[model samples]
Target: MDTVVQERLSTKIQKAVRKTMKYIVDEHDVRARRFLPRNDLESILNKKRLEQLFRELLSNEYASDTATAIPTGSDTGSAEGHDSSIEIDSAVDTCVKATIGTGNVSRRALLALFLYQPHTRLLSLYVEWLTSGHPRIRKPSYDDHEIPCDKSIPFTEGDLETLNIPFTNHGYIMDYQTIFTPMTIRKFTHHDFKTRDRLPFLGAKEKIKDGSSGTVYKTNIAPGHWEFKTSDGRFLPENPDTSMVVALKIFKTIEGPWGTRDAKEVETDFNIERELLDSLRKRNISHRMIMLHWGSFSVRDADGIPSYHALIFELATFSLEAFLKDEECYRIFTDKSPVLAGLVDIVEALHCLHEHLGFFHLDIKPENILVFVEPESVHSGSNHEEGRKLIWKLSDFGLAREKGSTRERTGHRLSSSYYSSQPSTLPATRPAGLYQAPEIQSSSSSQAGPGSDVWSMGCVILMVLASIIEGPEGVTDLSSKLEVFFLNAAGKQKLFYVRNDSHSW
Candidate 1:
């Protein structure tokens, strides 16, 4: 190869190696921070050793290049050959000295090099050094040693070995399921409620509301005796009979041939909701905005196929729709301050879902906005509504989709009843709700995106603002005036919206 061309190729290869090293270092840094003590992790990624290793690697590369380039046979003993070898060695030494002297190689770069080439003999030496009882490398365990022995530190090497974790050829555990199971199990065991076989015993559920997709029921849970830390960093004992209520949402199941196909579809939707909620839980998103998912369970039919799917969530006081209809609660919204504050809260929740989590809650409506009243106010029957705290949370994510995902069509209502009547040409029927965006109304339009969710939220905010400004009577009057009647395929009058010249609602 031409000298210049070879040099260019080598430079590109070096750049690629450095980039890969950086990525590997970043990935391991994140994982190590979660499971390993900071001091121990820093020791494991020793900077001095990394710099030495990098210098040796560079020297070896240059030495190999010189060996391949030098003349073979009797010419190897010539003065010309000896001079060429000395010059190559001199250049390689200069480059190595410059790399170390300039402090160009960082600890991360060194760690990356080791991680990127784990099969290299150097990595085995590094591992041996790590296990040689270095003072900085403390034994893997939780920071606090005063805790009970039964409360084992999670994800330790011992624990991983006990679980018989499978490791890759590179000596790294790649089985995320086995690694995360311990944490998941710990979370469930330490949760506020106890369960039997991973299924919480929700006693005698009362139907709260009926929807096309499923029904929600309010039920009490058998509370566990787990102690939890409060916001101010104080541990508090949980009351076993403090009336811990939860919401149980059961997905609707069908029967027969068509129903059998529909059952699978229902299961798919149930899994989507569960997975989304689980994602939120794993990310530790604010429970004040997004409802906390406790657990999920399914019932199988005689053929051993799943028939009924249910999810357990933290119960809210009431839906925003129901709250507005209540004479007492409606009065609270009459004050513009509370209404504006509530709107901000809901908007922040939507922002978290859309921007932070990259999820679009396609079904945003007043009914899906759950309201949680302060427990003290609820029990004390406080007449001072202004002092009461109302937490607004976004719920009912059965129709939610991840941003940029187009594998499945959006806006399909979870109800089995609507499936038979759905038009074949359209991707899916728009959910039966007044808050649907304009793009969703047209059959030929593309799948609903993040903007669709914003539109629905805007509609909800509009209704909420109108209720606060004009009271319940004003909202009712406004709805009556905007109601447009149109004939459907069955020649029945259906309430719809007609766009004006400017395309405004």
Candidate 2:
């Protein structure tokens, strides 16, 4: 038994090392996007390895299952096969002679192994079993306790405190949860700008020509895109066509031309937003919404009040509105194209933002849903009816929030009907032109939770569906038509209660 376990351990680690190496080598490809973080694989693995111990989880059956999921023609629904981790028989440890360090070599060394031998699966399993729902069997009499939080667990107030996270209840859930969040994110107390310059990395990275955010640029990251942000009056990144390129988002210090009251609030909000995105990505929550890639802050002029924050993120194409518009003019393949697949992508992203990520995407317009119509993205949109895998990425986290990250100063002037959360944020008025939410009279960015964003998304969906129905032979030019339809739709009383806020807004 000891020999078998040891062999299993060696095989698992060896496989893990090789698997990690593969991702490291081919780090830029999309399919190579594993759940593990590229920069700190060993640490994440060591923390999550325990969930594999009592089952075939560490075995190739698990990893290959997700990657090479063979679809059985039958509709049994268990296409993943009846063989799941839960079905594995418990390996009762009857005591082995001269065992070679199995099971975190006893939980005492778990934390040490997590930091030191980060690639060590043994420690990861120990931590997970103690916290996850797998339910660690404690006594031979079947007294099973789901590894609830205790003193030695991986999650606790101690961990949150260690992480420097504030505002929490307890337990070691992700930072978004009450488990508490550490503050590695930046707080731009000082508003200053550096020299203006074009980011060299943007030119070197692969360019993504997705109209809305402008051409998306990607770099060789640990299986992700490295984005940069800019504020050239365009919500999109400033590309090589302009001097500053690179990163996902950039903030111009000047608060438009008119409203500059809570400029500090605006700068702080943006900085916190960018920093929060980076922090979330670190937690490895890849449900659907955009996570952070990389970020930096710099100023161009000598005495610019608010500096330029350059950010870089994974590449994605045009917005939903843009896609619909383009489809309206130029035929984007058949109706059975990856377009339908985008529906699933959209809902999945919505669900994650609302339910899992514990935040709201206040700006959930069609433009927010980035599309990737590249050749590789679609196996064959023409003939491959079921092979429409246009991977949609949710980007622009300028308005995302954790469960309780809304207390900061936001620059939004609210109307009367705005929710409490929305009104509380300091008013950072929008442009005089842009259309406001129906209930919102003035240019107010009342921070709605995920539900509010859902209201916006619901509006987008109705407009798209309306276009498809009203158009001649289905709305072919989705990209071009989306914005016009939405702007028009916003004015109309399209906000159905079901589609609108269900939560206490």
Candidate 3:
């Protein structure tokens, strides 16, 4: 039900954001300034990087989702029927699900209302979302939407033991499910330093392997680990110990005077990217969906150069493209799920994000996703066992936007980074155009809202489904046509997918 509701909610938000973008642009254009952002995402991506992103996004859809993914309740007590038996199925593509009643939400809502006066309004929003969805709920408050208990709920867990994730003593899935069960529902467990501050490391940084994100410095605390990233997005910091990371950024004070609005656009982009990543995590959709994991922040300076930046996730493996085409991938890898399952999972992830999270994965091609090449055999949620669950993570969040937050109406709706190369015979697509919602191109940008993400997701789907359809020569054209329908209003409203004859999925 949550997933279903999420899809509807994400769609509404997308529409709303696009609508808001039009309003902002219309108002701003009176001064004769460009209303929409310019195209730029792909031009910056080199051949190697583009290839890598294309592959990773399609790799086994991340460790957290592929193996034993389960949705835990929002309540403090054990979810109803935690021990009850559920009907087992034999299909690998289908999911196993059972309704045990809405859990902690009933209580989580009550507690949120009482503890935070501002959140009481959320009850109304949730109720509306629960019943009517985004369009019906005109006034929604982003201020207090967090779950009150870390505010995230566990997604579907396929097979717990397969993932090697830990379980609580009472036999509950630990990380995927609520950390505290229904019985433990206290209003203020988040405030307990012991719980929030407990570092989630299993080994020392010196002993643990550091992937692309680069060098991890061990802290004095036993087994505590921190990865250092320099100002440049890459991992080349000499010593990240003295770095200073900022929260709500404070303006720089210059000797002359304060800078103008234009001066702050860079900072705004940086903060927006960071906050956007944080927002993704807060939504419980997995940080991999938008960018590399943003873990901790710190300062480090060993040489004379002072590098200030964020402490983000250490990738388990290179991106899906490199891992796939780079000869190195074969030496260290094993395979299990049929190619079909891999394609299915990527579509599933994109679908969930588009339909549930309310944003666009602007770059839907294969290179942006990452496939972890870890060792160890694990069972998939479908009762199939494979060696080392593939962890396909999402990356490169620079171009993401909230639902309905597009600016097409003022005629400058194109995104930056979509085009940089000199155009060939067939002109290259603008970044916004690469994933542009065909319907929205004709309609107002504001009306395009969530469907833009749907359009991008469709491009991704076309890419992945290419692997399934027959005949390599004509696959691209056929897949594009097939997927274009998926983005149409009739498709979304009726929930149609001709291939599966699935109207509600």
Tens digit per residue, CA lDDT, model 3, 1-505: 0133223333433332232133333543322211111011112222333223222221211221334434666452244223211101111001110001133232331212211222222323233222222232222333223322222333234333332224331133232132112111111011111221222221223222221212333322111122334457533322223322211111121222222223234334445555666677788655343444434332223332212333344344455545444433343333425334555666667766666775555545445665655545554555233455566656555455555443221112323222114111111123124444443332232223334455655665554444334323334455355442332344522111342222335
TM-score of each: 0.51, 0.42, 0.33
Q: In order, what lDDT does every prediction score?
A: 0.51, 0.41, 0.34
Compute the lDDT for candidate 2. Answer: 0.41
Top TM-score hit? 1
Report each candidate's C-alpha RMSD, comma-separated, in the order given: 22.0, 21.2, 29.3
- Predicted structure 1: lDDT: 0.51
Tens digit of per-residue lDDT, candidate 1, span 232-320: 97544343434356687987664432233266677776777777677777775554687656667666643557656777777888898
Candidate 2 on 49-102: residue-level lDDT in tens?
433332333343244335555567655536345544332333212111101134
What ranges in model 3 sit over 4 Å off?
Answer: 1-263, 284-292, 296-311, 327-339, 377-386, 404-448, 465-505
- Which is the leading candidate under lDDT? 1
What is the Å distance of residue 31 in model 2 from its true position?
41
